[model samples]
Structures are given as C-alpha cells and as structure tokens.
Target: MDPYAWSWNPEGLVVLLLAAGYVAALRRYPTPWWRPACFGVAMVLLLAVSVSPLHMLAMQYLLTVHLFQNVVLAEWAPLLVVLGLPPALAAAIARPSAMRLLTHPALALPVWLANYMIWHLPWVYDTALEHPSSLLHLEHALYFLTGLALWWSVVQDAPHELRAGTRAAVVFGAFVLVSPIGLVMALIPRAIYGFYVDAPKRLWGLSALQDQQLAGVLMALEQAVVFFAILAFWFARFFAEEDRREEIDRSPEAA
Candidate 1:
C-alpha cells in the first residue's frame, strides 16, 4: 500500500464532500454570484498544492515540497476556507446544546491558542515529516481545527461585532508570533530534518540551503501578505465609517 494514497483517495473525497455541502448550504442564502466563485478559486489553489500532481512532483524535493504544503495548509488554505463562511454550515450542524459547548468562550480560547502552540513545536513538526501517514494526519487535524476556531471568532455568522481594529491587531499579532519560527529555520546552518537532507532535489539548481532559504522566504512573505491585507481592509473600513459619521454629524437635523 502506498503511504500517500490516502491523500488522493480520502483527502480528495473529503474536499469534494465539503465543497458540495458548502454549495448546498449557500442555497438558502442569497449569496452573490461572485462569492462562490472566489471560494472555488481558493479551493483550487489549495488542493493544487496538497493533492494534485504539483504536490506529487514537488515531494521529490522533500524540503521545498513540505514547506509549500505547510504554507498552503496553515495559511492560504485556512484563510480562504474561513473567508467562505463555512461556519454557517457549522451553525447548521450543532444543536443548541452542542453549539454552546463548541463555541463556549472558556473552552474555545484556550483550545485555539493551545492548538497553535502544539503544531509549531520543532519536535512535532519533525515527527510529522518522518511519519507522514500517521503523525501528519494529527498535524493536519490540528491545523484545521485551530483554523476553524480562529476564523469563527472573527467571521462566524453570529450577532457580534468584530471591531476592525481588533481584527487587524489579531492578524498582525499572529504574524509576529509565527515569524520567529521562520527566523529559527533560516538561521540554522544544517538541515534540521534528515528526510529532507536525504531526498533528491527535483527543482532547478537549488541546493538544500537554497531550498531552506526559499521556505523561509515563503513563510515570511505569506504572513506579510495575509496580515497586511487584513490590516488594510480594516483601516479602509475604519476610515469609511468615520467619513459617514462626519457626514451624519454635519446635517442640520440635530439643531
């Protein structure tokens, strides 16, 4: 049995089912034509990195490939999936009691942070790479669950105001926290993982050092793009609201 066969079979099936379910759920809402289109594009990009031929080809160069996979799974994929507002589907899944337990403030916050910390540990990361079939599953599950929790806090279909400033702060704070991990990976002179150092290079004229540097660059760039994009969105919203407020205040109705 091919160890990575699960990626093609089970993973692909899950992605398809999720996509179908998302479409079904959106039928009740008058979602604009473009919203599902955007979600589809994001899903394509994500799965291309994970389950497609690109992933298979890249895996020949373990370091670069694994880094690509990690960024897609942790950053790009999660952000896109969250933007899809799948929590509406989630809201459908749970009864009142289950929903209360799942979204409870005390349980949710700690689980959110703990999930983030657990996945980033060097030991856990290396172990996943070595045992991709077993440990990798755990790593992916943690990534997905933590991502759901984080996005739920911001984007869930709930009667809550996620202040623009606060959301920007959260995005940047996450970027800052994850940045040190990239720095550590870049600073290390030797290969941290034996699997990568042992695997044959598939890409053009790139040594292990080059591969590692590329990975670090990918990590830094991905974080900057995501964080700053969210920050700018919030800032724009803030200014727009301020302008509207000023316009309202200038009216003579108050006098």
Candidate 2:
C-alpha cells in the first residue's frame, strides 16, 4: 500500500455515532442554530483528522503529522464541543455527581496536564506507537476526554460559573504549565521517540530529528495561539465585569 495514499479508519464510526446522538439531542431540546453548527463543524473536524488520510499519515509516516493530529484531538475538537453545548444540556450533564467531580477545576486541570505529559514521555510514546495493540488508541481517547474535562470549567457556565478573572488565571496557568513540553521537544538535540526513527516511510525528505523538531515547533505554536486567544477572551470579560461593578457603584441608587 502507498504510504501517502488516502486511507480510511474504522474509528470514524465513533464520530458518526456522536453526531447522531447530538442530532437526537437537538430534536428533543431545540437550541440556537449556531449550537448545532458548532457541533457539526467539530464532528467534521474529528472525522477528517481520524477517518481521512491524516490518520494514516500520523500513524505510519510522520511525527509532524501525528503531533498535529494530537493537537486537534486534545484542544480544537474539545473546545468546539464545549462551545456547542447549550446551557440547559450542559447543566443537565453536570447534574451527574461523577461529572461534577470530573469537571471541577481542581481535578480537571491536573488530570489533563498529567494525561498530556505522560503520553509524550519517550518510552511511553514509543511503546504506544510500536504496537498495533498500540496503547495509541487509549492515548487518543484519554486526550479527547481530558481535553473536554479541562475546558468544562472554563466554558460551561451552568454547573458552576467561575469568575472571569479566575477563568483567565486558569487559562494562563495551563498555558504556562503545558508550554514547556513542546518547547523542550523543539529544543531537544535528538529525536526522542524511537518508533518514528525506525518507521518505513519518511515524507518530504525530513530526517527523523528534523521531523521531531518540526512537530514540536508546530505543537508549541498552535498551543500558544489557542491558549492566548482564550486568555484574552476571559481577560476582556473580567474587565467588563469590573466596569459594570464600577457603574453600579456610581449610580444614584447606591448612594
């Protein structure tokens, strides 16, 4: 089989089922058009990265592509999924005790960070990639789940609304903690994951070390853009809240 040729992944079934469930939910609980649109876009993105040639490229050919796929799974898709959840639905989901505990900022942040850090460790990363029984699928699953949990505290206003300042802090802290991983990968002198080095297909004539560096750079850049945008949004909200409070204080009724 041609390494770069388009390949289909059975994993697309997971995305399809999720889309179907969301459609059913929409029928029962009508929402603004944008909600479903956000969800549809996210599902399509998930399908594209998982079911399309991107999946095959990441699995068999390039570390750079794999890193890109990981970012989409762990960040973009989860964020969009959270954005798509209507307030009523989010509140209902959060009513479950287990979900409340899982999405709590205290637990969610650390777990998400750990999930990300542990998977990227050289031995662990290689081991997952080396076997078809490949802990890889598990890794991807955890990434998506933890990513969802991580965003819950920031995005979902129904279960518990964090103060705007607090949300900004959360985003900033997460960026601070996670940024180093990619920076280290980019700066490291050698390719850390042995699996990529031994893989049969080398695309674009990139050496293993070069590919590793490229992946790290891409990961770092993407994280910076996404995290900073979120931070800015929360900061704007924080300032707006403060302005509203000041206006209330200045009102004749307050005096």
Candidate with maximal lDDT: 2
The 10 consecutive residues of candidate 1 with the worst lDDT sum are 1-10
lDDT of 1 by residue, 1-255 (tens): 232332462555666777887787787754656667756865786677657765554444546566666666666666666566544554654336655554443454556556656665756666666676677766766666666555555545442345666555656666676776666667778666555566654355666776776777776776688768877887787788878889898886766
* Candidate 1 residue spans exceeding 4 A from truth: 1-7, 57-60, 86-117, 156-159, 200-203, 243-254
Q: Could you tell me which 10 consecutive residues in candidate 2 have the lowest summed lDDT?
A: 1-10
Give per-residue CA lDDT, model 2, range 3-68, as digits (tens). 666655555778899889888887777889898888888898888778678877888878998888
Estimate every model's Cα lDDT from 0 to 1. 0.63, 0.87
